[model samples]
Target chain A: MEPLLSILIGVLVAGAVYLMLARSLMRFLFGLILLSNAANLAIFVSGRMTAGAPPLVPDGMDVPPEVVANALPQALVLTAIVIGFGLFAFALILAVRAFRSLGTLNTDDMRVAEPKEKG
Target chain B: MSWYLSLPLILPFATAIICYLLRDRPSGAWVSVAGSALGLVAAIVLMALVLQNGVVAGQMGEWPAPFGITLVADLLSAVMVLITAITALAVAIYALSDVDARHGQLGYHALFQILIAGVTGAFLTGDLFNLYVWFEVMLIASFGLLVLHGGKEQIDGGVKYVALNLISTILFLTGIGLLYGQTGTLNFADLAVKVDAVENKALLTVIAMLFMVAFSVKAAAFPLFFWLPAAYHTPSFAVSAVFAGLLTKVGVYALMRTFTLVFDHDVGYTHTILLWVACFTMVTGVLGAAAQSDFRKILSFHIISQIGYMILGLAIYTPLAIVGAVFYLVHHIIVKANLFLIAGISQRLTGGSDVFKIGGLYKSSPFLAVLFLIPAFSLAGFPPLSGFWAKYIIVKASLDESLWIVAFIALAVGLMTIYSMTKIWAEAFWKDHPDGIDPKLSALPGRTALLVPVIGLALLTMVIGLMPEPFVTFAERSAAQLLDPTEYITTVLGPEAMQAADPLEVAP
Candidate 1:
């Protein structure tokens, strides 16, 4: 499961890098989403797989009786996912705003902040 | 103990909430100033406590070390927080005049306070994942502040800044994941203890490189700093000043912390890479500044260049070198932020930020010119200024290692820095106004509000410059703490944890 998931992360990252390298700001944003999800998935898989076992202790018990799944990485990934979602949403809106104000979605064309020197 | 650790983080956040509620009123900006003042007091308390106690660590929710969130402050973290509070207070006051009512009504003060909170949290956190959370907090608020004006230029710059920084954020997150998988612990102290137990040293080095790239982007090192100069000049002067002063330094701080604490296993490999990166970051940043004619843009590029010097100190990795790094970090923040604030006053007086378009400042505003000269010359490493001591220490450290080329690069970059500063001085201060107008400081509205922080910070530069004895000593203590973390580790994890990790130690 770990090896397979690693391959999946690789594929996702490859696709993300491709999209991010594009000229359009929209593509770059989509790339960001893909790449962030890959990171989240990487976190999940790296925690190791323990199918169907909850990481909960029974009542009055200080520790679980069985080898439960790793809960820490799940918590971390959950936090990363939420943060990534918020940032992606912000990036998406920024792209919309950039399109409206700058009149282009191409990063090369969006040079208003750093205008080319006039010859 | 926890209260001391949490007060600096809490004041900014509480102020953020209060300022948000008062965002529509004119008093909202005043609330930010009051909040920053309280934060400064909190920082002073924290600094005093850290000075008395070698290293202080507090566990959240009463959970013991290696299992809970820790807020730890050694000498280095204490001073970073102190300087952060000072910069916050200065920038907050400047914001009182610089932020217009419409922008104020847009919740600018709230975002600014939140940014301060995030920065303070980054300086204090003892857990890696917690540091990531704070980074996001800082990044989001910065996103809001960067595009607060909603101009075409702001939006354009925001896109690039957001895109690049998010990539770094993902890389950082990924690195955290891989490291957690390797060690199964996120606490810095725990990692410092357990990393030696890891059998696969090669994989750990790979993870270290992942962290290196991630922090390099944050630090604005060579080949990854395009987003900084592109976006920094697009924001408000207050926002840019704080960003210039605090943001990248957070990256540098993280690099310093992790490299010293957890990743010292392969310093030969890591520090050498950092050595080249620092040299390039310096040359490219200074050269980039030389090519720019805009006021803020030149300062923005110089931020990258100066970051190189701090990284050089880190790369050298000696007791003296770490001292240089710590001193450079403190001096650069004051001088860089002061330069940006002065740029604001120059913009206000001259009605433009382009150095070529505006002039007569020296003839009309000698006081402003004098204020500018302090930070400008200090930045260019003039003797008896803060920058001189900083550059001297870093260059001296490199020469001690007999890395003459690195020392030469450091000196030559300082010279290049003087060229850029003199360019600004010659053009913006000395040359006649292209439109035949005198850029008088007194004529500018809100001149007192604008000039107060600049004067306060300039005085600080002079103090540090003329009286380097105490600061150098303080930096030496901080560097000692960084190079040897036994005191820090014990404070964070208790002596039992340390003894358990090394059973051969004789009981004292």
Candidate 2:
């Protein structure tokens, strides 16, 4: 399970990097989403997967009686996903605003803040 | 007892909510200022408590260590929080005049307060995962503030800033996940104990490199700092000031904290890499500054360079070197933020940020020129200033190690810094305005509001410079704490955890 998930994460990261390197801002946004999901999956797999086992302890017991999936990584991943969603939404809006105001999404042309010096 | 730990975090957040509700009113800005003042009081109390108690730790919601969220303050965290509050209050007051009513209507004060809360949270958190959460908090608020006015240049800069920072954030998250897999814990103190027992030392080093890369981007080190100059000059002056003062330093703080506390097993490998990164960051940053013609752009690049000095302190990994890093951290915040505030006033007076287009500052307002000279010269590492002592200690540390090239690089960077400062002075202050306009301080609206913070911060720079004894001693104690974190670990996890983790006792 760990090996297969690691391969999937690797592929996702490769694709995301390719998309992120593109010149268009929309493509960059897509890459960010892909990359964030890859990170979430990485956290999930790294916590050591357990098959169909919930993390709840049985009643009246101090600890779980059987092997259970790790709950902490799940919590951390949930928090990361929410935070990633907020940031991705923000980046999407910012890209749109850049498209409208700057009249292009090509990163090379969006050099208003640091314009090329006159030769 | 925990109130001391929680009050600094709570005040700014409470202020942020109230300011958001009152965004449409003139009083919202005042509420932000008053809240920041209270935060300063809270930070002072926390500093006093840490000074007396050695290391103070409190678990949130009564959860025990290694399982629940923790708020801890040693000398480093205490001083960082204290300095953070000082910068916040200064910027909040400056925003009363710098942030216009239109931005106020758009909830600028709320975002600003949230940014402060995020910075405070980052300084105080004891859990690695919790630190990442605080980073996200700081990131979102900064994004809002960066593009609040939504100018073409602003959106353009925001794209780069957001895109780059998000990449770093993902890397940091991945690092945290992998690390948790190895140690089964995320608390800083717990990781410090467990990491030594990891079977695969090589894999641990790999994870350490991952953290180094992620945090280097945050600190705006070389090859990853292009986003800074791109975005910083686009924001409002007050936003730039706080971002300049606090944002990248959070990265430096994380580097200092994690490297010292958790990743000390492979210092020879990690700290060596940090040394090269520090040198390249310094030379590249100052050279970048020399090419800039704008006031704020020059200051932005200098931030990258000064970051190198702090990283250099960490890279050297000596007690005096760590002391230099801590001293540099505090002094840089006050001096750098004050420089940005001065840049704002300079822009208002001269009607532009490009140094060539605007001039006559010296002839028109010697008082403002004097104000500018204080931080600018200090930044250049002149004698009898805060930056002088900071640069002095860092240089002495490298020389003590007999790293001739590193010492030479540090000194040469200081020289290059002075060159940039002189350029700003000659171009913007001494020369006549190209358009023949006299840019006087008195002519600017809200002159008092702007000048007050500038003056207050300048006095701070002077105070630290003239009386460096207490500050040096404080840095010494903080460095000792960083090098030997036994007290910190015990305070956070209690004495039993330490004894249980002690291998010698276990063998018996």
Q: Provide the TM-score of chain B versus the true chain B for each model in turn.
A: 0.98, 0.98
The pairs that clash in candidate 2 are none
Name the 10 consecutive residues with the lowest summed lDDT in model 2 chain B.
Answer: B499-508
User: How many clashes in candidate 2?
Assistant: 0
TM-score of chain A of each: 0.95, 0.95
Model 1 interface DockQ: 0.54
Model 2 lDDT tens row, B310-396: 999999999999999999999999999999999999999988999989999999999999999999999999989999999999999
Alpha-carbon shift of residue B430 in model 1 (angstroms) = 0.9
Q: Can you tell me the CAPRI class of model 2?
A: medium
DockQ of each: 0.54, 0.58
Model 1 vs truth, CA RMSD: 2.8
| Best candidate, DockQ | 2
Q: Which stretches of candidate 2 lie over 4 Å from their true place?
A: A117-119, B502-508
Q: Candidate 2: global Cα-lDDT? A: 0.94
